[model samples]
Target: MNIATRTLLVATAALTGLAGTALPAASSTTGAPTTASNSCPVKAWGYRGHYMCGTKLKAGYIDWNRDGRTDEVFVIAPNRHIWHTWKNAGGWKEMPGRGRADDMVGDNGTGSRSRCIIVYVIKKGYRYYQNCHYNGRWHNWTTSG
Candidate 1:
């Protein structure tokens, strides 16, 4: 278990959960990792937060609200979990969840490309769960491991 191996394992755990789940991992083309948001306009999300990566090295972005624009950013912190965010009328809002973000996909409104945010959570290499915010409420990420 050298550093590279650990990094790969941790990155894999962050991308796909260690158990039963079926969502194709999104592709990230942001080749080099950015150190900090230093300039992300979104308030609650950028540069630093609970989910901000301290070291390891993994990240992604998505358009949580569809609007044909990217409004959410996720970072896989050294702790191996997903820190996330999105926007609303009030301001920026954090998508509430714990554990590494295994996989994330947009709810394409039955294939119309109307996007919504959904996150799959993985913990301890076995526990698995998912959550999403829709119709104005935070659904608890219940464990089904």
Candidate 2:
């Protein structure tokens, strides 16, 4: 074969080999769910901070470990008091104290008072440490019962 013809054939063969070896660009799409799961509960207190003063400490919801369901309820007092209650327990139970400063204050403005309760639903074996005030007064979030 002539030089020009031979060169053309070689180029064509190279192009064909490249096309056979190459693949089309892959898609960059994902298949993740848009909404959150039902098991994972939402947190009333976004962070580990005190809520607004005199907000009438209410029971807040949280998933804690994010399992998609609210299994735990937390009672948070402005005086840094924390109580962990579960759905199965049927009642509230005080957690061990960490000896931290009070988040709420007393009428005298010197001592602290229990004024809040936050509820959190977390998975089993999930341990959380918090500092809170435990004055003898039982502050209920739902009602004055």
Top lDDT hit: 1
Q: What value does the lDDT take at residue 124 in candidate 2?
A: 31
Worst 10-residue stretch by lDDT in candidate 2? 30-39
RMSD of each: 10.2, 26.5
Q: Model 1 off-target regions past 4 Å? A: 1-59, 87-97, 102-129, 142-145
Write candidate 2's Cα lDDT for 1-145 as tens digits: 7899957754554333212222122112211111212112222322222332332233244343447665444543332234345555444443342211112221111123433332221213321222333475443322111
Residue 120 of model 2: what lDDT? Answer: 25
Tell me the tens digit of each residue's lDDT in model 1 across 29-142: 222122333222222323334333333222246655456665655544323344455553232233454434544432333223333344444445645454555666656555
